[model samples]
Target: MFLILFFFTGFTIIAFISFLDDIYSLPSRYRLIFQFCGILLLLCQVYYSSPYSYWLFFFLSILSVGIVNAYNFMDGINGITGIYSLILIICLSYVNNFITTFIEEDFIITIILSVSVFLFFNFRKKAICFGGDVGSVGIAFLLVFFTGQLINTTYDWKYLFFFSIYGLDTIYTILFRLSKKQNIFEAHKLHFFQILVYQTGFSHLQVAAGYAISQLLLNIWIINYSASNPLFYLPILFLLVIMHFIRKKQGLAITIK
Candidate 1:
């Protein structure tokens, strides 16, 4: 119906405009405009007939847009996007099968097959083709939709842990940059994965594999223990501690004299 059409059409527009930007180096503001237009169209088509649902969708619209961009921001390293995306998609597919079927399982399988092929090209010493904005943002939008549907169906907020791996890195990186008085919008090699590969001398595959492994572990934990308690944030704290020590071990953190 209208929902499917709007979703695909918006995704197409954003992917197309972002692909152009990848080629021609379009201004950031113009690219944002296209992203907002696409996201807005998708949001408006949701079932928001009631006032509560309308406001809920409105809130989701803003959050989804940020997540879409965050996925793009994390796409800098080779293999990182394809690998992390594969992990998330696989976990979500599991959730669909065993826990709750918010989305079509076949659709999830299709995504898995596609990302597996992408990893063959991307998870290598030399990438054959970069995902470009189209690949990253497009996949981001798709993940957000699946995650949102799961939340809507279950009414459990803890399911947001599905994004814990990327969420931690993105949120912490933004705060870290703000504390350093850097322009958050401008691109830089500040993300944790970027630091691991660029500064620590880890190969792209190593760092990417490390992230995917860690996420796989976390997903296993989330699946075993329901994260309904407030203590669910404990796992994220452990991850932060691990990242801190990793930076220290790699000589990337500044030591006070």
Candidate 2:
């Protein structure tokens, strides 16, 4: 009961502040400070965990806060963030049972699933709140912590591959932008999803589906690879080509030098 109360309090406070920030156009630095504070409070809630768990959640808290911002920066279109969160939550629920964690497994899944449903409505066409820094960061923080718990229990680093799609997009987009001497932080349409949205003439739903589908396919492959021949995992390029083909058909692929 206390633990649920702890998470609910933390989530409510963060969401409310984030809602305010979205409407009032809060300053970035202020958002960062709030993110840090939120992360701190969240850490305090789980401080009673073991030394290793404590350290893991601590690392995850900091990183989750950053990822919250990362996802926030990238979420310019409709349905994207909600879809992304949904995918992560579903995957976590499916994967968590396989790995043991001190955190109540079903509770984490229930909370996130509930959050995603509510956020979906809030984010659809008319966003009540833009997920602001709070929503993005909180989701990121929680997901990463969940991932950490899984990693700690399973001890299988291959699970990291599940997040490879996001890492690829975010890292590649940043480097690609930086190479052109552009401000990587500034809003730009260089992201593959953005390209599909603007260049390919894909609807927001289509573009969001593309990303979710690609990642889902990769995760499916991960599940299969774990059971059968690891050798089948080769030819990632083939999969990339298919991904590009589908995105291009929708109108988003650009010729890269």
Candidate 3:
């Protein structure tokens, strides 16, 4: 209970800051500071509830912040957050029920229902309102806490595949920028999904659906496979290769922007 409240309070603070930025464009340093504060709160929760491992704590803090930022970054288009978040929450709910009851089932249902309402407004031919930083960051914080609980309970690294699609795109894009000596922190639209929409003329809904569908398939695979096996990563690797080839075929220069 304390852990939950602590994380929520931290999430509210971070989201409030982000919501302000959505309107006024807050300084990057201030945003980073708030993000770090949220990270510290989550880390404190973990420390209080579980056995301490310095390395694991550090990694979780980093990963939690990364997920928060990645989710926000991917919120570039309409319907993507609603559709992809729906898929992720549904998968997590399933795992909680049939595989391992790591988190509250009610929490999952609440998020699903909330996301359903959000999807109603945003998933159509025209969007009414965006999730913005507040919506995205709040949801990301919830997911990170739930995912951390699952990992701690089941000791299953395979669960990390939940964010596989977004992680691949974000990590690869950053690396690609680094390779070109570009400022990775600068805003750009070189994400493969972005390229699909901007360069290849794919609609936002189509690209969003593509990611949600791909992730749904991956979740099904993970649910059936043994997390302890080293081969659990093979499917993600295969999908990454396919995505790479597809992007390569587009022949768009990442250096252009």
Q: Which candidate leads the pack in lDDT?
A: 3
What is the alpha-carbon lDDT of model 1 when measured against the actual structure? 0.80
lDDT tens per residue, model 1, 188-231? 77788987877778898998899888888888877777666666
TM-score of 2: 0.70
Index of the highest-TM-score prediction: 3
Structural similarity to truth (TM-score) of each candidate? 0.89, 0.70, 0.94
Residues 1-257, model 3: lDDT tens digits: 77777777787778888999899988788988898888778767755667758888778777878888999889888899889989999999998999899878998899899999999999976899788988988888878777877877887777888998888988887877787789877888888889888888999999999999999999998888987777888988998898788778887454555
Predicted candidate 2 versus true structure: per-residue lDDT over 64-164, tens digit per residue: 56566667766767777667777776776776666444467777768676777766675455656555555665676676556655665565556656665
When 1 and 2 are scored with lDDT, the better candidate is: 1
| lDDT scores of the candidates, listed in order | 0.80, 0.64, 0.84
Give the Å shift of residue 225 in candidate 3. 1.5
Model with the higher TM-score, candidate 1 or 2: 1
Pairs that collide, model 1: none
